[model samples]
Target: MKAVIQRTANANVTVDNQKVGEIEEGLVVLLGVTHEDGLEDAEYLAKKITNLRIFEDDSGKMNRSLKDVDGSLLSISQFTLYGDTRKGRRPNFMQAAGPEAAEELYEQFNDFVRKENVPVETGKFGAMMDVQLTNNGPVTLILESRE
Candidate 1:
């Protein structure tokens, strides 16, 4: 499991010219699942993301977690996070989970976040999505469960 977490003033996903999911003053989470990912990974990542203290506090210090700020989450499935580009000119996606497994884990991850009582929105899995966001502070971080 992996995720690219970005603090955003607002974010939304569109599919076939239709908006699917949207959020404001939250995190745009590009989530990825690999073959080895399981419930534990989903649980851990969800907890970490919700509690991540990237939002600034009143003193202008980056010390407020998403929960602290009552922020939302826009989760998008992105298997390409596992793309291995070390060889040749093309990237290999052999490490990414198959569709069935990936979708299941993706839903699980979203469910985990929702269980935390945080507003959670999501993009359609396996769909070609156009995501738009006003990245707050342009703050981005990559999180991996395995390491």
Candidate 2:
């Protein structure tokens, strides 16, 4: 599993001109699932993301966790994160999990975050989504379960 986590002032996802999910003062998670991913991978990422101290604290240090800042989560399924572009001009998605399994894991990931007491919103699974966000501090991080 991989997560491209971005701190955001606000974020939303739209599908077919209809808003699917939205959040404010939270993180926008572009989540990816590989063939090897399972519940354990989702569990690890959820814990890590919610506890990550990316928010600023007194004296301007990034020391506050999502919980500390009372933030929410906008999770979006993004199989393209596994795109391997090292070879040719085209990116290969062989490492990404199949759609059915990926969607299951995606839901499990959101359930884990919600269990952590962070308000969780999500984009439509397997849909072409238009995501918009005001990235807070421009803070972005990529997290992977394997390494």
Best by TM-score: 1
lDDT of 1 by residue, 33-85 (tens): 99999999998999999999999999999999999999999999999999999
Model 2: number of backbone collisions: 0
lDDT of each: 0.96, 0.96
Q: Once superposed on the true structure, which residue ranges of model 1 sit more than 4 Å away at CA? A: none
Which sections of candidate 2 miss by over 4 Å? none
Q: Per-residue lDDT tens digits of candidate 2, residues 23-82?
A: 999899999999999999999999999999999999799999999999999999999999
Question: What's each prediction's TM-score?
Answer: 0.99, 0.98
Lowest summed-lDDT stretch of 10 residues in model 1?
A: 114-123
Model 1 residue 76 CA deviation (Å) reads 0.2
